[model samples]
Target chain A: MTEAILKVEKLKKYYPIYGGVLHKTIGYVKAVDGVSFEVNQGETLALVGESGCGKSTTGRSILRLIEPTEGRIIFEGEDLVSLNDEQMRKRRRDLQIIFQDPFASLNPRHTVQRILEEPLIVHGIGDKNERKRKVVELLETVGLNKEQIKRYPHQFSGGQRQRIGIARALSVNPKLIVADEPVSALDVSIQSQVLNLMEDLQEKFGLTYIFISHDLSVVRHIASRVGVMYLGSLVELADKTELYDQPLHPYTQALLSAVPVPDPDFKRERIILSGDVPSPSNPPAGCKFHTRCRYKMDVCTKEVPDLVDVGNGHYIACHLHR
Target chain B: MDLDKAGENVEEDYVLEVDQLKTIFRTEDGDIPAVSGVSFSLKAGETLGIVGESGSGKSVTSLSIMGLIPKPQGRLSGSIRYKGKEIINLSEGEMREIRGNEISMIFQEPMTSLNPVFTIGNQMVEAVLLHMELSKKEAEQRAIEMLRQVGIPRAEEIMKEYPHQLSGGMRQRVMIAMAMSCNPSILIADEPTTALDVTIQAQILDLMRNLKKDFNTSILLITHDLGVVAEMCDRVIVMYAGKIVEESDVRTLFKNPNHPYTKGLIKSTPRLTSEKQRLYSIPGNVPSFKEMPKGCKFVPRCEYAKDICYKNEPELVYVGEDHKSSCWLNIEQAPSIEEDAS
Candidate 1:
């Protein structure tokens, strides 16, 4: 059996909404609520959802970037929630995150060399000479040349800047990298290049990735296993083939059908959901997707459905499945 | 310059015809050719898609046709005819009559394109008032009807609301409603649903399709998404470095693409139906305007580039029935490399 590198149990991140004169907490934006998943070593687990579905928040909460409100994040068999800030800082060497926008993430003023070496310096990995050498190695690994080390972030194109971002994330040699919409900002041609580089790196490093993106096509290309999220909850989780071919949940079925296929002759029977994703702050009780779900029943409005495995490690959370 | 009278009596073959159109921008660093000798035509009730990457000049081509390019730094050459009438060198006042009434454009970011401070009713009514010779009440009624036509529920309440009050999908629908409010002969949509999510994107695309069917509006779709192109467009134009490298019917463009850039773009896009072990990526970046190569614009990144490809740029030629591609391989000895190894 493959070793599980990171396991997230009932992860919940709620940002309090302030209201009235006294600034009393009226409610919480349930961005990520009761999200549970496990990442095996050297596998890409994609978390996909819409804009306010809490895919990004789940990724951030896994790295303790946003400080998840509840649930345990057990990494390498250690409970990260019990750890202090200083402990978490030291533990972060094994955990790194690559952001969506390459333009905004990197320090514009700093050179690529300085930007890369900062992680090594903060982690106390090696000396100046060794760190400098590692930066060049990181650049070469990500398909960039050593000559570009002195240049700033603005000097590179969108694809090259993304390469720089990847190199920075790889400077410390993290085991798990939470890539939050890594290639969404890039054009189609450049986006493929980055995706290939990421896959190659995963093979070379035996890395674990919690790939968070809204684009299902990209997710299908990179992920070994897929988890579908709806309004901060995991609606369905299955192997890539099983999920795409035979999705259990109605929302997953709709989302899968919604993707515009590239072939001109392919006419998919699309499930265009009416209305927008509801406000996360006041999300519907029981099933968050009931408002948009096509097969939503009366029981879906009253009782919350637990993510239970039916067969072949395929888990689903829906009243129909239950 | 009545809106109804424009393009009303013309029994022209093509609704819009662009011949050898070139747009150059003068910057601190010399004149950069944003669009170079590009030519295409839009027939009545046809959707022509211009597909390209960020700097492939697709948006610039659309903007040039719209007469939206800034006057001081940008210069336009060649011909743009609307229903057999020259419109390239028309005065600003003359262009204004045709801008929204004859043709309208919907931008990528609806939030930025829309006036945030003004109510939706005000913006829609103003657009209608500018083009159609209708009273305020009539215009307001027309705006609400247009909004309802685009599937906006509670149209009256939405009319009173501001731009920020609606979601991304709603905002794009508003932009579409405003653009179609004038019953334009041609609608130029530059990455209309690029900002929204996939589900919302599907909804907007469906709306656009239904609207196009109902009104028979000719659409000039400019986007980087191949899937969108495959679904919406009847004819597709693949642009690279300010030139049309390939032009064909949508089926031919996807099935048997002639240009290397077109092939690469089609292969690179991951399809939901099929699974590719590794996505085939083009090797290098798109060359900047200042650092453009001597011959083929895609030479640096192209795998099939030959010696002759570096010497002289190949002209866009008919490669198949209703298909055109610009590549030296079509004219000269083909490259030694086998195609579609992946």
Candidate 2:
């Protein structure tokens, strides 16, 4: 039940929308519109919503780092949107990422051993003292201390510069990372020590993540299949305890009853969803979350639903239990 | 709730007290302190909260209770008092006549805390003509009635619009209608919806619980969201690397959290109705006050430390009935709750 290792499919990215001073186009902002999922292998998926819901442009269009205009990411079985940027720069060394501002994603004049030895010197790997012992063993496996690898990223601390951006996305050993809001600019007691050092470096490197967040309680603590995203499509995916115990999308039960649960007599029934989100360059024409659906129907503003599954593996999209 | 039988008319039962305050900063690599001995009080439409994270001094104790710090480079000290008076060494013309009329903060980037070339009706009529005696057409009719009591919708065309013409939840409801246009009996706010959007942080926590039930006000609030302090505090405190490692009543600090850094910030957050598979996280790094350790600052990230919690400094005590905590393991939590209920 676990082979996938990234699939994606209907994808789409869009942008276009020009118009002001003779610059014509004027249309698309769809931003990852027909999104699809898969992930599997070592698990962790996530991708959540809200904030123009493209879920960080579907985690930078599965490492094409934004340039999707349409379908198929595939990975490990090719198709990273049909490669070629000289074979997607050798498939960007098994694609890595981890951004969300560890004080503006590091490099305040680089130092943590030249930012973990510039990704093992751009994946050339060993040549200078075995790239300074793999940049001091990726700064002691992201807990840092190879004598603070000559310090710099403004002398470390937004949880040691997100453990030097998770030791520069595990210096090229990355078999898929894409972490985006990696602990949303940290400090909730260092976001659980960088989500338990990204779940102990994905159980010591069998990796495959894609996390991208909007903090659904840090995606119910490091996902393992979640998805959701809205304006730019893919309405739901499942298992993280069946989408936090039975969500089946109404925007995942108003984003898991709009999060906020640090208990104080944990009450429930929230589902607020009133106004805002709309314009992904003029979105609404169909169930683009039927304008913040509280189960809206009447073919939710002229059709579009389609995600489907509804069984043990949960998938969703809408038309109230399709 | 009884912060030691106060006397000297501390404003007839606390409307903001503070006491052991502190602050510090004047650094040439020296006195950084940053709100060390912070005390509490609030009461009258209560709320309280604080919590911590990020050099835990909860925005320098709400900028030393809004005398907005920045003095001879931050150096504040004990008492703050407010209605009971002291106002931490007043005079910057008696603290700009108790700034925004007896306290009113609201920060966490309402886009650089507003003022992109004025016009939210000239900054809510220059804070209501610098603390009320009104007049530029009666402070533009009390800034269009605080931009229509903060729900802002054509409230006189959002007083000629500007803070980059709205939306980040309408510039945090025009910074909560310019900090409740001088309704200040203590508002402060700080991480006011940490740059929003969880459906506009549940519509700015339901517009700050309906402006604290229509301005009975007493807020304070600072953040680091323990779910916005269990949806708008009642009594909290917590902080860390700069003291008060726990104080209670937000349902007994979310049901019995007695400081091992408030049970590692309520078992390192991530809840949305619990599932866990490893995430308790409080292991090390937060000492900083140029490496302060040798005795509790969560003793090098605690796992219930032992040797007198690394040689001394515990004292917060009181457990339950206004549940305090500082922790030398709450003096063995009544023999570890009778050995975990036999």
Q: Give the DockQ (2 decimals) of all models.
A: 0.86, 0.23
Task: Give, for candidate 2 chain B, the lowest lDDT window spanning 10 residues.
Answer: B1-10
Candidate 1 per-residue lDDT, tens place, A1-322, comes to 2789999999999999999999999999999989999999999999998898899999988889889999999999999989999999999999999999998999999999999999999999999899989999999999998998999999999999999989988988999999999999998889999999999999899889999998899998899999999998999999999999999999999999988888888976899999999999998888888899888889888888999999998999998986
DockQ of 2: 0.23
lDDT of 2 by residue, B1-342 (tens): 222322222565677788888888888899888678878788777778888888888887887777777778888878888878888867789888887787888888888878798888888898889888967998999888887887777889878878886778888888888888888888888888877778778877888888877887878788888988887787888888777888877877777676767767777777778767777777767877987877777887776577877888887778777778878777754335322211
For all candidates listed, what's the TM-score of chain B alone? 0.95, 0.38
For model 1, the stretches where C-alpha displacement exceeds 4 angstroms are B1-12, B333-342
| Global lDDT of model 1 | 0.91
Q: Report how closely model 1 matches the true complex, as a DockQ value.
A: 0.86
Provide the overall lDDT of each model, using Cα atoms, as 2-decimal numbers.
0.91, 0.80
Model 1, C-alpha of B209: deviation from truth (Å): 0.9
Tens digit of per-residue lDDT, candidate 1, span B89-130: 688999999988999999999999999899999999999999
> Which CAPRI level is candidate 1?
high
